[model samples]
Target: MISSTPTTVTDRDFATEVLSANQPVLVYFWASWCGPCRLMSPILDKLAAEYGDHLKIVKMEVDPNPESVAVYQVEGVPAFRLFKAGEVVESSEGAISQQKLQSLIAPHLAAPN
Candidate 1:
């Protein structure tokens, strides 16, 4: 089994964890039945492990968290939203290449505080 650090987020924790976090965060919106979501899990896991300090990666289930779903306007599964200093900095939907994921998050990673 792929070993990735798991940080589960919900409506109650969304604001504090995703928005108010001191570190850049990657919030993954997905469902258990989503094929693309499953495919991307391993990649996300690897990223979480590799960038544990600089980035905070959290997985959220949309079905169970209506508040987060509506709040983020997540209309589809396998959505990735990057947050920096309590603001949404980037987002992507559907299947994403590992390279693309890195590219999208690189700016936030490199940005000076």
Candidate 2:
């Protein structure tokens, strides 16, 4: 089974863990000091549990992962990018509600077996 917990990624392993993932990957760009990011984590954790079999949720701290931040154009905290087939298919910035976040990825998730 896929993990129910959100995985952490780094610039060094981003390509392998996210870009090359077999399923769609939701990449969350956040920082330690960002309150909004902290608020968003629980929502992500919930989604990770619900969608783990069909999707991969990953977190990348922007402060320590500058290469990924610059490459992905993440200029602010609480940015999200959904990668499918090795390319980004959806993206969002700033605070987002759980419903909106689900809608953003629902269309991309695999159907239940």
Tens-digit lDDT track of model 2 for 3-104: 999999999999999988999999999999999999999999999999998999999999989998998899788999999999999999999999999999
Estimate the overall C-alpha local distance difference test score of candidate 1.
Answer: 0.87
**Backbone clash pairs in model 1 (N, Cα, C under 3 Å; residues 3+ apart or in different chains), count:** 1
All candidates' TM-scores? Answer: 0.91, 0.97
User: What is the C-alpha local distance difference test score of each model?
Assistant: 0.87, 0.95
Query: Best candidate per TM-score, number?
Result: 2
Best by lDDT: 2
What TM-score would you give candidate 2 relative to the actual structure? 0.97
lDDT for model 2: 0.95
Candidate 1, residues 6-97: lDDT per residue as tens digits? 59999988998788878888999999999999889999988988777678899999999999889888899899999888878898988898
